[model samples]
Target: MSTNDDGIEYVYTRFITRNGKRIYHQKGGLYKFPKRSKKSKS
Candidate 1:
């Protein structure tokens, strides 16, 4: 996981296949989804 100066957060996950092959998955972009706040008003 990482974040840039522009506050753009990036996340990546690595997976190993049964054949010993590596796969990478990534998400996040300039238009990433908004994060939910933990503090909610009743």
Candidate 2:
């Protein structure tokens, strides 16, 4: 994972998931992580 000026970038590696028929090693790719909006109470 890396933090850039625009957003956060994450790289996935090879690994089999425990459930949801997901596999990391087979579906590895470079993708950007979504940023959450912070809510402030007035």
Candidate 3:
């Protein structure tokens, strides 16, 4: 999973088949994790 700078975060899981083909799942959602504060570690 990776988050972009434009406030768009992508959540994906990678799966490999027996044929050695790479498959990626792109689930759709605009999720925002609460920003970490100076007093808290995220």
lDDT per residue for candidate 1 within 1-42, as digits (tens), equals 554444444444444233577544465233332333343334
Regions more than 4 Å wrong, model 2: 14-27, 36-42
> What tens-digit string does per-residue lDDT give for candidate 2 at 1-42?
564545454645565345557555656666555434343334
**TM-score leader:** 2
- TM-score of each candidate structure, all chains considered together: 0.28, 0.34, 0.28
Q: How many backbone clashes does candidate 2 have?
A: 2
Indicate the residue-level lDDT of 20 in model 2.
57
Model 3 stretches astray by more than 4 angstroms? 13-42
Local accuracy by lDDT, each model:
0.42, 0.52, 0.45
lDDT of 3: 0.45
* Cα RMSD to the true fold for all candidates: 9.4, 5.9, 9.6
Worst 10 residues of 2 by lDDT: 33-42
Ten contiguous residues minimizing lDDT sum, candidate 3:
33-42
Clashing pairs in 1: none
Worst 10 residues of 1 by lDDT: 28-37
